[model samples]
Target: MPVLSLAPRRSGFGTELLTQTVPYQLRGTTTLTFKPGGLQCTIELPAKELLQ
Candidate 1:
């Protein structure tokens, strides 16, 4: 298993940018469904499901 994080990295000119270690938008479609007791999410993903 691999570890996932959301920290920005320093780029040229001292600018901060998100690392592309994992796909955040998930094919540009990130969906989240919330219910009374639980929640549901839908994202077009790859072979590995990245979760915290």
Candidate 2:
């Protein structure tokens, strides 16, 4: 299994950025699936690691 971290950037003009951290597990397979949205993304991990 692996961990991921995300950081948000701040603007001097009073604007803020949105950020999030998502954790995923890696199994014996080697494929990563993700969906992208407006300023956000969703990721799916393998099955084997989920059982661990």
Candidate 2 residues lying further than 4 Å off, grouped into runs, are 1-37
Q: Which ten-residue region of model 2 has the weakest summed lDDT? A: 13-22
* Worst 10 contiguous positions by lDDT, candidate 1: 13-22
Model 2 Cα shift for residue 24 (angstroms) = 7.8
In terms of lDDT, model 1 sits at 0.38
Count clashes in each candidate, considering only residues at least 3 apart in sequence or on different chains: 0, 0
lDDT of each: 0.38, 0.33
TM-score attained by model 1? 0.31
- Considering every candidate listed, which one attains the maximal TM-score? 1
What number of backbone clashes does candidate 1 have, counting pairs of residues 3 or more apart or in separate chains?
0
TM-score of each: 0.31, 0.26
Candidate 1, after superposition: displacement of residue 19 in Å? 15
